[model samples]
Target: MHTTLLKDFSVSAAIAGFVTVLVGFTSSAVIVFQAAQAFDASPAEIGSWMGALGLGMGLTCIVLSLRYRVPVVTAWSTPGAAMLITTATGVPMEEAIGAFLISAVLITLCGFSGWFERAINRIPMSIAAGMLAGVLLRFGLDVFISMQTQFVMTFSMFCIYLIMRRFSPRYAVVTALILGILIAGSQGLLQIDTVRLQLAEPVLTTPRFSLSALIGVALPLFVVTMASQNVPGVAVIRASGYTVPISPLIGWTGATTLVLAPFGAFALNLAAITAAICMGREAHEDPARRYVAAIAAGVFYLIIGLFGGTVGSIFAAFPQELVLAIAGLALLGTIGNGLLTALIQEKEREPALITFLVTASGITLFSIGSAFWGLVAGGLAIAISQVKR
Candidate 1:
């Protein structure tokens, strides 16, 4: 078993895993910290939040990927954290913990009941592909956008990426990342001094459930996590052509969240963006071997959980443009495939295009994200078109 695993490992896959963790943490860790602060959590408790989240994501990503031989990545629910920033303010920390528990229980019920998986399975592939393309369109654009400010670094990475793609496609993203890091380091853009090696300790908060907390915090957290995070997550998996069982994946994440909530794991769900990083061709030329990338990501997540402060600081030390450049470059292939699949079927083309546009528009209504709204719009379009037919 160990030899088989070693044979599957590749430098590109490991780099893909590192890039996934880097993007996931740098993009949203601050929001999670603020969510903890909103509930009047202490610094230690906030670190506990990071620790719990990291452990949950790490374990789920590793276990699920290995079990299914699919690149099943998991993450702290960024949308849930963002919602908590507003809704958790003035709520007692214990009550917030209670709400997290309630939300996790609800998610577990949905997953174990197989309802969420059934519903997601009904979403047409073209629509799912469109939503995914829309979801990732921004990241692809950012590769060039970064050049406006950090031309020397971003443009250098872009050129190197193109060159690598022409010669050694598997190493394009890795080359871009290495070149970006070197350029950032040479420019003194890497803030190495800010990184300190501090181990994270979990601080538990006892649950204090209330009807108001259930209505205000728990329900919204569950809704946002499902609609904004998990739905697109499932879409990404399907769009990438993986057929891993969805119910168990969702059930395990919810179960993990339930176990860790008292220690500040507010919500854990399937990761769309980060998962794409591990599922894309850049992770491995052979799709079957991509699971190793997720396993590598799990190891990184474990490191973050054990040394939450230090890992957080290390990700923070990276220059913003470098992160943006590498992420955008890495995702270029996935975005293109998503767009192509979305428009391939003539009957679904218009609806899929609408879904893509609506999602890329980035509009939010009633606190729900564009991904959900895009699905609704595409579904409605499909319905109307069928009626006409």
Candidate 2:
């Protein structure tokens, strides 16, 4: 592993890691903040939550990636946080913390029992690919949508991407990142004042368990994180053709969450969208070397954790168009590859297409996102087709 990192440390991989963190933080950090507020957490507690989550994610990513020698990226439960935003309101902060602990325990059990791993392993690769493609389809489209706001910046990045792709394939993303920053700065879109660097202090809260909190918040969070985040996360690994053990990965997340829940680590699970960024060929042409990107991401996440107080401002300082453009450009190849894989099998083509379309629709049913729904639709399609035969 040491040898691999020393020889395969590419600028593209590092940039990929940076881009993944930027997109993850800018896109969903607000939801996290809102969730914290719903629990009536003080500002200090919120900062602690950020620190705990950041440390959990960072440490997990580094340990798991190094252990497996695969890019086993872990993330805080984005969808789970969204769930809490609605369900956690009116609940006491103590109960909410209790709910978090309960959810963590449940997640850990799922991992230790190996039930979740078995279920994920059974998913058809075509459907898995379609689900991943569906999840990422929006980001891919955002690349072009960014043009309406930052035409010069978007077009310039796109052109540089094209030029670099033809000339220096490995550094295409790195070059685009540089060009995007330069263009954003030139246009005065960058806000320097919003960014204030400081250290974050963790605040611990004691959890008081309740049946109502368990049923209302804990169960829902656990279900959403598992169904929405971890499921697609497993698909990303398989879609990328890496065979890391899913059970232990899920188990470790649960364990980390259990230990850190007092500090606001609500739920930790395998990553879906952001993990794809690290797992893709753009991160490293040689799959074996891609773990470095995940490690790099872990380091950046640690920085975010230490400076949790400024995370919101720092990410906010970057123009929305830049974030959208960079994330879209970064995942372009992964989206295309997923779609192609989903559609390649003749018999599975229709089901895969249905999965992709449903997922891309962005519809929400029962507070669950379209990715899980897409899989359900694809499964029904396959089942009906098989029944006809």
Name the best candidate (by lDDT): 1
Model 2: per-residue Cα lDDT over 1-389, one tens digit each = 68866787788888888888888888888989999999888988999989998999899988998899898888888889999998986799889989999999999999989999988776899999999999999998998999998899999999999898888877888888889889889889889877888778988888999999999999999999998898888988998888988899999999999999989999999988999999887798888989888988888888888989697798898899889988888888899899999999999999999999999999988888898999999999988988854
Q: Provide the TM-score for each candidate, comma-separated.
A: 0.99, 0.98
The Cα error of candidate 2 at residue 220, in Å, is 0.3
Candidate 1, 4-119: lDDT as tens digits: 78999999999999999999999999999999999988989988999999999999999899899899999999989999998975789999999999999999999989999989
State the lDDT at 116 in candidate 1: 100
Question: lDDT (CA) for every model shown?
Answer: 0.94, 0.89
Name the runs in model 1 displaced over 4 angstroms: none
RMSD of 1: 0.8
RMSD of 2: 1.0
Question: Where in model 2 is the C-alpha error above 4 Å?
Answer: none
